[model samples]
Target: METVDVIVIGAGVSGLAAARLIARGGRRVVVIEARDRVGGRVHTDRSGGHITDRGASWIHGIHESPVAAAARAFGMPMVEFTVGGYQPDSRPLTYFDARGRRLEADAVRQYAADIRTLNAALAKIIAGAGAEATYGDAVERALAEQDWDAERKERVREYNDRRAQEQYGVGMGELGAHGLDDDTVNGDEVVFPRGYDELATNLAAGLDVRLEHLASQVDRSSEGVTVVTDRGVFRARQVVITVPVGVLQAGDLLIEPPLPETHRRALGLLRMNAFEKVVLRFAERFWDAGVYGIRQLGDEGEWWHSWYDLGRLHDEPALLTFAAGPAAVATRTWADEDIVASTMAQLRRLYGDTVPDPTSAIVTRWQDDPFSRGSYAFMLPGSVGADHDDLAEPVDGVLHLAGEATWGDDPATVPGALLSGHRAAQNVLGIDIPVSELWA
Candidate 1:
């Protein structure tokens, strides 16, 4: 049996980050990954002469993001897109009804205002309500208190649903009202001109990473921890389980002696929302090149709420369609051709008949992937701060949990995952190293 000071499971950003920090502290560490490659959910696919990020792409907080920091350290090129940069005369986000009619500017402004109202109401409820109060309940209460007509209420619901799905990978119904607060550092967002995977690759350099090693069992004892995998068994003084929340929820790995009741309960509290991306490559750009994104208000079945013009970033005639939560779950049942066809139908509704069929298409099914059952973690209603803290708590000083889910303030982001890993490594080593020092 191979032994090390620390064993990091899942070579995603979190695991890699943990391993790097541990190794820097002169502790022996090894990373076991189920996939043949690293970057668990930060996969960048290059096919048909275009670079497409099959997993996460954006640096949500460019200035303070750990991912962005890593990118700069790696000398990776990044490009920033102005929100609503295109369509100078209209709102940055162009909204169209189901029949493809552009929503009036007044209606758009009203929707935006309603969103602010809903958020303010949610904030008040979260401040006073118990952990069980869901965002859905908040939305319902806010809408009921309003004097808007049925049409306006419906519009508000539709807009909120789309926002929840896009941001949290779930609808408002599944999101925890208190947890929905965005605590991320604010800055201009940017994308990797080459690929986001470069950040993962840069972090993984010189590390002892074992690919295609699926961990089946993790048995912790008084002395240390033992991780059983399909390939081999690894013994380490401490183990960092950085797998996705969905993988933990599936109970795919057997934790001998069972995890604590609190941890188990916390697992149930956090929900893994489905999210996927469909990349369509066209021979030529048909949409406005200056616009950063497009949102369809009345889409059938939430198949797609919005799309980003890759041409703006990579100078390629490609558009990436985003689907999350229920829509992402529904898309799992669709074949590639079906997904492409349906998305194309939606595009046609927006751009008219002149929109051409894509020369090639690729769809990502993160939910169906065994390694990652869903994209990331979201707080469900009835969750409390202690829930995430308990989930991240180390067991017996040997078992540690680290991932985006463990990152309370910044879940569902690369920086969150990386920060969680750093925290886990710090916990395991019993040392405090500033994040700036790590980047330095």
Candidate 2:
């Protein structure tokens, strides 16, 4: 039996970051991970002569972000994530009609303005609605009250659906109108051209990371905590559990005394969303230059609605698209060939029949991954942001919880997970630590 001052579960950014801070504070720590690799959901695939991030890809925001600060310290180069991400006004895009004909520049810009107006209107509805109201209901009422033409209404509705999938991995109706939280920074979001998982790798350096060690149970007491794993058992003065909320919800790892009532209440309200990415590579750029993003209102539900020209981040000729919520659920049993074929049909609808086949393709099925269970956390009706804080509270002041789901301000982000770890370390040390000691 091995022992340490602290034991951290899950080698994801959260766990690694907590372990790093604890170690730097002169405390012994060990990290247990079920997978052979680090960066639980920040996976980067460098196969087939391509650098593609199959999981989390953005810094969300650069200012006041620990992850961004770490990237800067490592001298890593990053470019602003300016592709038309739900909010199209951030960057110029090549817009297409249902028939694949590119829309005029003025028309595309108009859509951006319309979306902004629509978003503002929806925000007001949410603000005025009660906690029992769903975002889907708010969107529906807003759209119903609009006096726009049928064609314009249809366009905005379609774009709104796609944006819902991209942001929440589910329909707006599935999200809580009063509970949704998206805390943003003052600066632009950014991504690393090389890989997003490098942060996890660098953070894991010099730490005691036990790969392939699946934690099955945690028994806590006043004196210490005992962590039971498939490989062995270990004890520590305290343990920080950084596994995904999905894992805890599924009872994959049992806590002997169970979580506090408040923790369980919060946990019950949080849902792990289905957000998957598909990476397509071609021999050469196919779309127009100076147009980094391509959005199409395809027919038949538009399974693939948005795409980005990865060349902006040095992934030349590669395209990235996301399928979330219902779209992702619909493709749960889809094979690789089926996904590529279906996506190709959509591309052909927009790029004519002469479009060539991609040299390679990478698809993610985070929903099916047992270790992660799903991508990230989203709130349901009757839930509130304070639920995240409740879920993050340390049990008995010995069993600390930390993860993206545990962070309310910036949930479902890499920085959220990274910062949650630092907070957990602070909990373990029983003091407030400065940011310089953690990231510097």
Candidate 3:
């Protein structure tokens, strides 16, 4: 068995960041990945002269995200898109209230403000000292405190539940009230230039990465942790595990002497949400060359959050359709034919007979992949931000955890994964590198 200062498991964004930082410290590092490719979930498929992102594509915000800095450092162009560009449907921009009524401009503005204020107040309550709250509780409190007519209250509750579900995939019963702040905590969303996979590949460049290596078990009984991979056994003074939260919950990997009670409990408390996208390509721009659409289907919220033009690319007929919450979960069991047919039907309703049939359609099912059981992780209401600290803590001087799941403020964002990886490496080595210096 070979030994190194640290053995980072998984070559995802977080693992790559950890390996780079640790290796920069003059420590021997080995990055073992399960897939043949370097990037874990961040994969781009290039076929027929078209590039389709199979995994993460958005930085969410360039000004505040580390992904933007990484892109700048590599001279990659970061593209910006308007939030309104992502509408629920493609045509007939009709605003529908929770009561299934078409909300006028004034009503829409009022509802939007109500949402903003409620979210802000909830965030403030969590930022201060209090028991960890879930999104359900926070919204409930907001409703109780505010004096509104029954119709308005019903509208607000329905709207909040639908959007929150679409955002995280887990409905109110399963989602954390406290987790609502994860999206806007830092205030920005940016997409990578070229593709996010490019950033991952660039980061993994020149690093010693062992691909097609699946970690089956981790032995931590010894003075150091021993990782058992399908290819070989690697012993390291410290091992940074950056696998997805869903993978950990699946118990696919064996742990010697078992993980501590605390770690196991923390893993149990964490839940994975499903967020999937389907990209349809046509020969010509069908749904109004550059227009975005939002369609509300039956007050349950959007079956697809919205559609956007692949404005970054030229001569491309592509519309990226996103599904979150129940719709996403339901699609897990759906056949490809059914998903495409249903989505196309929705497009017809929005585009009013103008939507063209897609020549090629691609749908990503991350939930089925053992390596990445789901897209990303989100906290429940009671899991306070401090729980993130507990999750990120290095254990027994041997095992360390890092990933987007452990990122507190920036969870579900690329920058958060990078920061988590850097922090995990620093924790193992007892070093403190400010966030500013990491980007520097």
**In terms of TM-score, which candidate is strongest?**
2
Per-candidate Cα lDDT values, in order, are: 0.81, 0.84, 0.73
Show the lowest summed lDDT stretch of 10 residues, model 3.
Answer: 84-93
Per-model TM values vs. the true structure: 0.93, 0.96, 0.88
RMSD (Å) per prediction: 2.6, 1.6, 3.4
> Per-residue lDDT tens digits of candidate 2, residues 1-440?
89999999999989998999999989999999999999999888888677888888888667787788898887778988755246676767778877778888788887777777777788788777777887777777777777789787778877776776787787777888754447344477788899988889888989999999999999999998999999999999999999999999999999988998999999998899988888888888777787667888746436787888788888468788887888789888999778888888888877878899998888899999989999998888888777887877888889999999998887888888988998999999988887556557
* Residue pair clashes in candidate 1: 86-290, 132-382
* Tens digits of lDDT, candidate 1, 1-440: 99999999999999998999989999999999999999999999887678888988887657667777778878999887544111112336667776677878787787778766766775676677666777777777778877888877776777766667777788878788766675333667778879989978988989999999999999989999999999999999999999988888889988888889989888888877788888898989887656667777664637676887777668778888777788778778989999898889888878888899899998898888998888888887777655676778889888999988888767778888999999998999999977654555
Runs with alpha carbons beyond 4 Å of true place in candidate 1: 82-91, 104-106, 183-185, 299-301
User: lDDT per residue, candidate 3, 276-370, as tens digits?
Assistant: 77888887765543444444534444575356666544456687777666778888899877888878876666555777778988888987888
The CA lDDT at 18 in model 2 is 92
| lDDT of candidate 2 at residue 111, scale 0 to 100 | 79
Clashes of 2: 3
TM-score of 3: 0.88
**Local distance difference test, candidate 3:** 0.73
